[model samples]
Target: MRGGVRVERQLRRLRWKLTAMFTAVTVGCLLTLAAVTATLDRRAEERALDADLSTRTAAVALTACFDPAVGRITVDDDSADSLVLGRPYLVVVVDWSRDPAGAVVYPARAPLGPPDLGALRGLRPRVGPGDRPVLTDLAGPSGGWRAAVVAVPGEGPVNAGMVVLVGDPAPVREANAELTRRLLTGCVVLAQLAAVGGYWLARFSMRPVVQALTRQEQFLAEAAHELRTPLAALLLVARGGLAHPARRVDAMRDTVRLADRLGHLVTSLLTRARLQAGTQRVDLVSMRLDQLVEQVVEDLPGADAVAVRAAPTVVAGDPDLLAQAVRNLTENALRHGRPAAGAAPVEVTVRDGLVEVRDHGPGPHRVGHGSAGTGIGLSIVRWVAELHGGEFMLVEAPDGGALATLRLPGAAARPTRA
Candidate 1:
């Protein structure tokens, strides 16, 4: 089974350190916001609970009525029944008073609700003029009572007496508490969402850096190949020159040419190294780009084969580097393509600050267009173009050959946008 099946594995595509940090920070902020919201909501709810308790307590105490016809104190059943039919309570004491032995229940009173009315003595609350009510936490066999006590007011002396206590279950408080729990849960969920979003955003934001790195690796590989080829050729030619009789002018001229070629190679290396090290200083100036191309065409390898097709196009830039890049392109085509290859008589055209090196040689159709010359020639051209913030394009010519085009902004061009 192992041998038959393809081992399918996925690699991590994101920078873990950056993504994790973004997630953590976002989640941390979300959690803090959630906690603050929960806290504020709970505080508002607590204030709400306090307000509700006041209203409810006042409603329960409204049962007091003065029986002026009998000159006695009593509770209005209609008012009390209005509270409930079998109203749930911890304890409801109809009569109570404070004494040395603590609160004692009056014998003539009635009791209702559960047996949790044990602590109905301490809840001091003002009910009316010189009359008070008490609310207590009562202990019980099963649970407890959050009780309220109030005095029944009388119009005359009819022994209408003091206390009336009532209580409800503790679960109402639990309901209020549950509201806070739900809010906290929502806050936690929001925090998790923020963490996930932040991670993806962090990864997306830094994608450019990853792309730059991948391209740099490819460029280094190509650069190594380019440098190796020229050095190899120079070494072979130098050894041959040393072994042969190089006393004649033609032989001396060949040696001089070899040294000059090597010098150009070294200069290219320095240009790249300086740019990489941030030591390359840009010298932007207003100049006629068309004139620059014409001058460069004059110095091209096998200058006789290069023909000017149009007038000069001007732009502002470092003229020397731009000229060198054009020269490199011409040299590459001349050195590689021969008389019979139909690549003869290279064409130079300039318009709108754009330079084109067109050849009638065997076209790039023989090799893929994407190949940046598996050699050093095109590398030097691209490096110079990129150094000046210019653009390059290589394409097969209509006449069974190839063309290299370079475009750069001149002094007359608009400023770069940030």
Candidate 2:
């Protein structure tokens, strides 16, 4: 029991290992998805900000006018009011006509400090008459900002003035920050869900292994119990022979019989273990089912108790394992088939791709009866039938006995023995 528990605990740890592997894979995929999403979002935000700054700079340039009389650039009253209402923008117009061009701050209603004007001078504007507006990024004390510098039109050989418009990118930055937080939160939830799903998947995958292991442990315990009886009898017979010299021969005979039974039990255990472990190589050959059944019946301990009604059915199977299956079924019938008074012997039938053993026993009550190693014997027979791509069934006979059937696929044409 302790050994079985240890094996089960070890298997449980394997389940966790499988779960951890599954979860790690899921998390990796999710992390990749999150990274791609964040990168795309950042690019999109940058594009939108660039477009916004260009549009606003065009608006400022369109509204500015150069007065050659004053040699200064000025905005109309409406444009001046609108520009002042817009927040987080610095508009400056520099007069190229002046030596070291004089810079004029737009939206005069709103004050532009020395530092803001000083930052605008660092943003070089096009001084040529027809140069296109230049868009660039500017880093400030607060954060990053986008700027568009355009040459202002004037009646002069050289450009009379230059318009510089700068826009703060705080809104886009705030939106991207919010999106990142939400994406991370969603990833966390998805990771938790993946962990849960992985745990269940691991448990589901291990269910078959657990069942097979449980059956193996049960088989070992039953084999030990079966061996104990013959071993105890041998010990008793040996002790008697030593204590009583006159009846030593009788005790020796009993001991030999007990030892023989022990040998049979050991052989059966080994055969069953090999079959269950799928290590038994079945050399299938062309054989007649009736001949095999007759041979197995003749060797049975209670051979007289079995009546054979076999037809000539040719099949492809390992004759040795097939014979073993038949022997186990006969032994099972002899042990459990309790006939009524004058009832016919236990019947063994071979026909229609089926080998059936019917006994006048207590019908369905005989099923699951582990007494005298019946369960393991039937188990071997069942496994043999399945190995040949067939089936084994135990049903209540119509005449109130137990009916055990081993069905194998019949050959299309009988072939010569290989």
Candidate 3:
């Protein structure tokens, strides 16, 4: 019980570790993807903002006229106002030729307060490679601003004049912030789903390991139980032979029999272990099932007491395993089938890829009534039959006793002798 609890605890720990690993990997990947996506989106938004600023600056520049006679730059108020309306920008015509001051022609009143005139005077109307207005970021007491400066075509006062379109970048900033929030929210949701899926997958993967461990524990406990009785009996028999000189011969004979039984039990255990561990491969081959059965019967202790009626039954199977299964069945019948000392002989019949062992014993209930060994032989037989795509069954005989049947898949028919 303590071992089982320990195993369960270890399994639980392993499952949690696996789940954590899966969740961590998933979350890491999601965070990377979200970061990349946010970066791309921010760049796209900035590019769009710059494009709009340049277009608006060009439109404002077109409306401005430089009058050298008045030594001042004039802009069409209606056209500039129409462009600035419903937009988060203020249009200003800067006369660099003057005291670096300009007139704000649009919006009559600024929503985010007036423009920073000190900063505006520092602006230079520069064009890029394609004569595109150079946009610049301006810091002001009100907030952040993006400005595009385009020079009017004609000259007026000293330093000429330039159309400066100042835009409030609050909307762009808010949009980027919103996108970040959504990305974070999506990441959180996906991380939770990944954790849940990881846990479920861990549990699913550990199921088979748990079952195999449980089966191994059961097998070990049963094997120990089976070994204890015979070991005790052998020890007691050895002590009895030492104490009684007259029964020494009989005790020695009994010791030999017990040793043989122990040897058989050990062999059976080894075979089962090898089969389970896959160290011993079941090599399938075409062979005569009847011949195998006849060979097993001839090797038994009392071969004459086991009468065999076999036909030319051929099957595809591991010859060694099939022979062992037949031997186990015949031995089980010989040991448990007889009700009295002089009862009917155990009968083994092989026909049509089937081996039927019938005994004149009581029935299925009494088959292992007085047996000293654990019934692992029958289990071996069952395993072999299943491995060969066959079945093993123990049912009451029609007349009396028990009928044990081993059915195997038949091989293709062979050519008969001419």
Candidate 4:
């Protein structure tokens, strides 16, 4: 019982470790994906804002260039007013030729006051590959702003040399902030879900391991229980032989039988272990099933009390396993087939890849002589039959006895010589 508890604790620890590893990997992947998505979204928003600022600046500059007034530039057209009036940005036309300190032409009423002219004039206009004006970000008193600076080409009295358009970037920053918040929330939720899924997957994977361990523990307990009685009897017989010299011969004979029984029990346990652990491989060959059953019957201790009727039936199977299976069936029948009045002998039949053993004794539910043997023998028979793609079954016969059948897939019977 303590061993079982220790195994359970160990299995729990291993399960938790596997869950932790799986959760960590899942969260790492989710965080990486979120980071990449946030970055791409920020770049997309910046591009859009830059494009809007550039388009407004170009419209204002074009209107100022074609103004009818001369000796002084005035942007009084509807198009220029529409681009700058009541907008979330500032537009200033600087006349370097008129006043080197810079001049603001549009927006007669300044809300945030005039922008810093020295800073505006100091900025170097970025030209793209197509000679398009690229917007630049500037730090302002109120907040950060994106500015597009465009220079008028022709030298005329009406044309302002520089058109500076500045737009507040608060909206873009707010949008990016919101996007970041949503991505973080989504990542947290996904991480929780991943942890749950990982734990479930770990438990699912450990089921087979748990079952195998349980089976091993049960096998050990059964083996110990089965060995205890025979070992005690053998020891008692040896002690009695030493105490009484007259009964030494009988004691010696009984000792041999008990030792043989123990040996057989141990061998059966080992065979079961090998079959369960998959250490034993079935070697398939074409062989005569009837001959195998006959050989098994002939080797039994009470061969005279058993009757065999076999046909020329062939099957493809592992010869060793099949022989062991047949031998176990015959032995089990002989041990349990005796009635009080001495009924018919145990009947063994082989027909069309099937071996049938019918005992005219008590049924399977009743305990009889030699019933102390562990049921491992039947388990081995079942395993061998299954390995050869066949089956084994034990059923109560209608004639008040037990009938055991071993069925295998039939192979073509060998050709007889003329």
Candidate 5:
């Protein structure tokens, strides 16, 4: 018999494997999706901020006027006020035509006060044509700013120039951070759900294995219980034979019978195991039920004490297995029927694919007392009958004894059922 601890360990291993697999796959997919979404969202936020900066720069560039002869340029106050309202950061116009490069032109003076202008001066050197906006990060005494410069044609002093627009990126950063937090929470929840689902799936899948193991345990336990009685009987008979040499022959016969019973019990267990494993193949062919019944009665230990009235009954089944079933039923009747002198003989009837063994004695419970052979034999007979899509019954006979019956699928000496 397999140890219970081994079985439990095997089940636990399978469950953990399933849980890990589920969590890895499910969490992997969620994290991948979250990463992709975050990338796309960051790009989108940057694009929208760039679009806002480009719109403000275009408005300033369109309104500004420059005179070539006077070496002067002018920009609209309304445009500068619109850029600063509901927004943070400072703007300055820069001239690329200067000999040193990155020379402030329109804002020739700082309007936002003399905070560190180095960050703004650095950005002017990188400006190009207004076809695409040039962006950079600027940090000064006022705080951080996301700045973009777009070059535009000027009338005179500032011939090639750019309108710079700057804004704080705190809101966009907050939105991205919030999305990341939510996605992480979703990943944790999905992992929990996967763990729960995977555990139940493992348990459901293991049910068949657990049942098979349990059945094997029961088979070993029951076999040991059943074999004890016959083994004890055989030992007693051997001891008696040695003590009384005059009755040694009779004692030896009893010992042989007990040995035979023990062999039958073991064979029954092995056969059941083979059947359950599907290793024992049944050869179903056309055969006579009565012939098998008569053979069983003849082979029974106390055949002379039983009477059989069998008709020509045909059936479709494995001939060997059917014979075994009949033999088991006969043994059950002889061992447990408890017939007295002059009592009606144990009657076996076979007709129309049905076989019945009846004894004229009290019912099974009274007659089956102290007999380990009682239940196993009947169980085998019932199993055999059902294997061929037939039925077996154990009920009270008309003579007040137990009646065992088998109904197979065929007519008497006729073609078998399809």
Candidate 6:
């Protein structure tokens, strides 16, 4: 995989993350709203049920005669026959020994056929006016019902009187069920729209960062081309100077010096290009960490205080990039460590998985401390460290200067493998 090309499988980016977050929150809100509304509807239904029970209690209470010996519930039969309850109502009077389902001695057929007596068996047998009504969710085959069963006048103690009851649920509850369904559907549609909006929000929010990266890419291409022109010019001037070195000794020296400086600049640019384009992967071979560090220190302009700790504490990594990282750190330390009185020598230490660069200059000026190498060196250090599953940190040096550390990962550098 190329270095700059970071492939995110989906959830790694902000758009999907926002969409998922909004969806979760929306579902939760809708479910809670549905639950609260359902509970309230049930409470209201009970109030309606109590009102129905009061009317039934009044009618049953006033009736004068129901004696077992007489075998008849005496009443104003003409008025009872003419009575009509607002909703579906059934008033059946079973024969003393008739099977509840087999024969309806006087089935009230005005409503939905004989009351679907399966409901009659379930009614409360003795509920007077003040008794709390027990309500439930089952509605009889007639679509709605609230029945109260009064005992027969004969069974005085246990089931003392005949059962008298009513039918149907309150109108409000029936309507509530339909209302809730409509609300939930509306919420689902709104949530889907919210998720789509969240995705676009994330996309537009990230536009500036994308634009900055594009500009950097373009700048690098132009800069590399510009540097090549000077490098070629210096090389040509060196060739002319070399052809007449006896007479142009000074010119020859200047030409070679310019060529060297140009060559160094070209290398740094290429490293940046390779890293940015995402195509720099290095093959590892057995090598000595102690030797590599020593070589980097030797190659530096100043290595007086460079020190190696532990035997070659090697690891698998891109040796070229690693060497470059160390050199950059050394140069950075030298550049920033020029003190009022020339600063003490910078120190380099390698131990465990870490390479520490410590200087005794008066730390960084406030301008540079924020991200440590808003410049080139720290950036390269940070990238190389993480690419190897390690890290880089800039800390206050115990003495005076800043401490830059690169902690890397890999097997310990050792002797050549068999």
lDDT of each: 0.56, 0.75, 0.79, 0.76, 0.73, 0.59
> Which candidate, 3 or 6, has the higher TM-score?
3
Candidate 3 colliding pairs: 97-158
Query: Please, what are the lDDT tens digits per residue for candidate 2 over residues 1-418?
Result: 7898899899989999998999899889988898888888988988876776667667777877778788666766567447646676667666656543356555664332322545555654434455466787766666666777787787756566677766677877788888888888898999899899999999999998998898788788878777776787789889999999998999989987787767767767888899878899988888888899998899877688888887788899999889988888887787678876786558888876678888887775755455565766777888888889877888877768888888788622221110
lDDT of model 4, residue 132? 51
- Candidate 4 vs candidate 6, TM-score winner: 4
Question: Residue-wise lDDT of candidate 3 within 124-178, one digit each (tens)?
Answer: 6353223357789887677788888877655423345677788888887788889
- lDDT by residue (13-45, candidate 6, tens digit) is 665887678777877887788878877877777
Which sequence of candidate numbers ranks them by lDDT, best first? 3, 4, 2, 5, 6, 1
TM-scores, in order shown?
0.67, 0.79, 0.88, 0.85, 0.75, 0.44
For model 4, how does the per-residue alpha-carbon lDDT over 1-418 read when each residue is reduced to its tens digit? Answer: 9999999999999999998999899889888888898898889988887888888888877776523356455564566657878776777776645674647645666544568766776763342222255577776778677888776643443334667788877777788889888988998998888888888999999999999898799778777776877899999999999999999999999999889878777877887799889999889988888888888878767788878888899789988888888877877777677653555558887887888888877878773335555376777789898899887888788867888888887622321110
Candidate 1 lDDT over 1-418, as tens digits, reads 2321321111134545656776677667766776676667656654553444344445545655555676544555555444434434321323322242332322223233334333433332333443434444556555654444455555444324344444445445565467557756776786577667766776687667655554555556666665565566657666676777564445556667666766666666666556555687768787777777777778755688777765555566776677667777777666544454543457677777677777666676654244333245566667667877877777776645667787675422422110
By TM-score, the better pick of 4 and 5 is 4
lDDT: worst 10-residue window of model 4:
409-418
Candidate 5: how large is its RMSD?
5.7
Clashes of each: 12, 0, 1, 0, 0, 13
Q: Give the Cα-based TM-score of candidate 3 against the true structure.
A: 0.88
TM-score of 2: 0.79
Question: Which stretches in model 5 have alpha-carbon errors above 4 Å?
Answer: 1-40, 43-92, 95-116, 135-145, 154-159, 309-314, 340-345, 365-369, 408-418
Where is model 2 poorest over a 10-residue stretch in terms of lDDT? 409-418
Best by TM-score: 3
Q: Candidate 6: how large is its RMSD?
A: 12.7
- List the pairs of residues colliding in candidate 4: none
Q: Which candidate is the best by lDDT?
A: 3
Residue 218 of model 1, lDDT score: 51
Residue 34 in candidate 6 has what lDDT?
A: 80
Model 2: residues with Cα > 4 Å off, grouped in runs: 55-90, 96-115, 125-133, 139-142, 151-161, 245-256, 281-286, 302-304, 338-345, 360-370, 396-401, 409-418
Model 6: residues with Cα > 4 Å off, grouped in runs: 1-71, 74-84, 89-109, 118-140, 143-146, 150-158, 169-174, 222-226, 234-418
